[model samples]
Target: MDTSSIVILDFGSQYTQLIARRIREQNVFSVVLPCTAKIDEIQAQNPLAIILSGGPCSVYDADAPPADPEVLNLGLPVLGICYGLQFITHHLGGKVSPAPRREYGHAEVELIDRANPLFSEIPANIHVWMSHGDEALELPPGFHLTAKTANAVAGIANPERRIWAVQFHPEVHHTKQGSALLRNFLFSIVGAKPDWTPGHFIQSTVTAIRKKVGSGHAICALSGGVDSSVAAVLVNQAIGGQLTCVFVNNGVLRRDEFQKVQRNMRDNLGLNLVAVDASERFLAKLAGVTDPETKRKIIGNEFIAVFDDEAHRIAKQTGGVDWLVQGTLYPDVIESSSVKGPSQTIKSHHNVGGLPETMKLKLIEPLRDLFKDEVRRIGRDLHMPDDILQRQPFPGPGLAVRILGEVTPERVALLQEADDIVVAEIKAAGLYQQIWQSFAVLLPVKSVGVMGDQRTYAYTCAIRAVHSEDGMTADWVPLPYEVLKTISSRIVNEVRGINRVVYDITSKPPGTIEWE
Candidate 1:
């Protein structure tokens, strides 16, 4: 089925993806293209509307990002965000210059044109989140003012041209009416219908997958994580018995994750799953590897090797396997690279399994266009257990990335124990679902501590918990003092090797979620 898409042109803004996310939340599909996209490229989506994303550049600056002015001449309903507004005004015979006092945070917008469909039924005064330094001093040709702040223009419109633009961001939560404003643009202005649902997605994706993999069998590397697990199930629905799901134990998984994932995939979910205990195999390859990148490579190569062998065996049974299903999400596709900006759209899902080139298998990424939350909705529609859909995000290398130093079996066991305690404590406090990730890291440096009146030098366990809508940005979660105390005391008393437990409070800007 042909879907109505709203095309968003990227102008190098940090909030560009957020604009796409907001539109997708409305059940009207949207696509993002770099600002450098040609006019015909913008036309290729058959866009119902064109959204210009906010960027960090100024129109008058010599180094400002490139844009196709012809995009406005296409006669599509146009909505411009922060930099988008300035870009439109500057290109259409309007004056744009630095504001006397820049608006960088929350501001109040007073709607002047109440009858405009873009502001239909919205309150006259609204609290909006602003981040622009430039202000429109004069109206563009045929454009009239629709809204304004005390210091700057907030909204403008040229109804005959079917274009509207806003100075404040309508995609962020800081603006209380952000969603409502976007809802107005999508429905009242652009006439988009909310037809994108999980059920619709499942039906469409299954049809597409079946059409692509007609006579060829597809094999999935199921990590037991939600992304892979959901991908495996979606593929199974398409190919039935032809899809073989392989779950390999890389030895660095969380405590009992191997058996737990096995139960969920095989006994509970009824997938034709093949479980391989390559724990010993992977641990040996990572034996003394300490550098994070080296450990990651060794683990990834070993996984590819293990999965390849399994694929070869399965191929022999099914005549041949021709596709590899991956649980790649849209965020992975968005942030995978840069095209002279914060991000550029990645054309393909990063090989989820890092399979060898010789395998010559085609890629089937059912969830590549979806966000994590959207994937969960599809999982629910498929009747997948909450345990599988709600599982926290885990790194590709699993606990190897959690452990700061050597990848030894003993350290793995120690971190797993401490990690389990951290999760258990968080869950007991009813914080498991609220927090993004709650895990323990095994630090390489151990400190001296008194245990049972004996001085002991043991490994230090660092407890890390974070809050984020996506893993791309996160803030350290301040688990309650009591909860932290419980996690710390339990790790010290229960885990034999760890004498000290510390909490990580770093956010994503200066530090990543993981220690490595």
Candidate 2:
């Protein structure tokens, strides 16, 4: 279970986690450490290799972040990326100059030494993703410039000392042969072993949970999403029947999702369950809330109020509980960090900010350090039913975000009906397992349409479906025309007030998963 091959020091790079993903894809275990990680902590990990991630700030900035110098002195193999490369060059007495013409994307790299360790297996000429304003102007002593692009030095290597740096990102897929290049650096140069798996993580988390919540009861908020369900089952394994699950049917949930999730939990995991029907309360609070932020705030605060009241009452009925378990994952941490440079705060996670500050319960986050795929594996290990394990991630605010305008009971019902039809059709077509996320959105705008020779002004429902690995970056899934036709037909026929159903083909840069 102690499989540590590569240690990636995050320098506020947006693609820092992607480097770890690539390493894991090669079956080599890797861990991400903050750039500010202590020298002792780095040494404690005993990494076979190190990769310095790219950052956003200039090296001359007063508070510009840099990796601890001791990380380089560890006498282990190292690879530096983008800002990481510049930092390495500047740290080792090389020169970094601000480029008058900054390189942003798609630079061709010409390899100077085909025999170099980093380029050993990779081709001599390749394309790399470039996004830096500063370029290395000079190489340090004993270091040889091993690659060049049209603009400046693209790569540097000191074979005598196992050090290498690249101005372009080898982590992103835009860089051709990136995996092969990283594999050469990890396996051929650093000699790393591939040994990380979900079973190991499950055992580690179970041990941690047992130690943290010994003889104490815990309550988990079951949103019927993969993350929460997996976290619930894992925590359930640790504390057995002491864990009480609260499934809140906020009015914003997908059509009949409450009943479906209830069945899943009972027939699947068989844990202590309390189904709270608080839809009317949520709908009442959400009425007339047009702004997205206000809707989120209102829904989040209301959800906690209902759940907290239920938990307090449950405690009085049964016994006292100590921990409020959550399914907080790793991406939530990285996306929330103030240190991630130039990264846009996509949306505030409700479960993260929903809890009241004065709540006295301790937290048991079993999936705190995990990713989506890792959560799925833990679900599989816990023998959770496939229905729960394969369910797409649903926001804690549910369909509240999917509705573009005010959260009304009528709109919520319409959206739920449309969403259920889409989900059921996808499941029937055997395409549910292939898509990462699929949902219905109730756009605020109403359009003119004619049904049975009667002109009517009705809401336009947009269907969003995308295929992604981790929900970070995604492309719209090219659903078959037949499947789309079926979903559209069902939505228009079954869901009242929806005159039209349109598929959203826009990707993440222009549109988010949720309509709001």
lDDT for each of the candidates? Answer: 0.88, 0.83
Query: What 10-residue stretch in candidate 2 is worst by lDDT?
Result: 335-344
Q: What tens digits encode model 2's per-residue C-alpha lDDT throughout 356-458?
A: 6566788887776677777787788888888888887777778899999888888888888888888888889898889999888889889998878999789
**In model 2, what are the clashing residue pairs, if there are any?**
none
lDDT value for candidate 2? 0.83
- Across 1-516, the per-residue lDDT of candidate 1 in tens digits comes to 266699998887788788998999999998888888788777787789999989888899999877878888889899999999999999999999999989998999999998998887789999999999889999799999999999989999998999999999999999888889899999988899999899989999999999999989989989888999999999899889989999999999999999999999988788999999999999999987888878877888888889999999999999999999888888767665333544432111223456788899899999988988999999999999998898888888889988987889999999999999988888899999899988999999889999878999999988889999887689998789999999999999999999999888999867888777
The runs of at least 3 residues in candidate 1 whose Cα sits more than 4 Å from the true structure, single-residue gaps closed, are 337-353
**How many residue pairs clash in model 2?**
0
Error of 1 at 58 (Å): 1.7
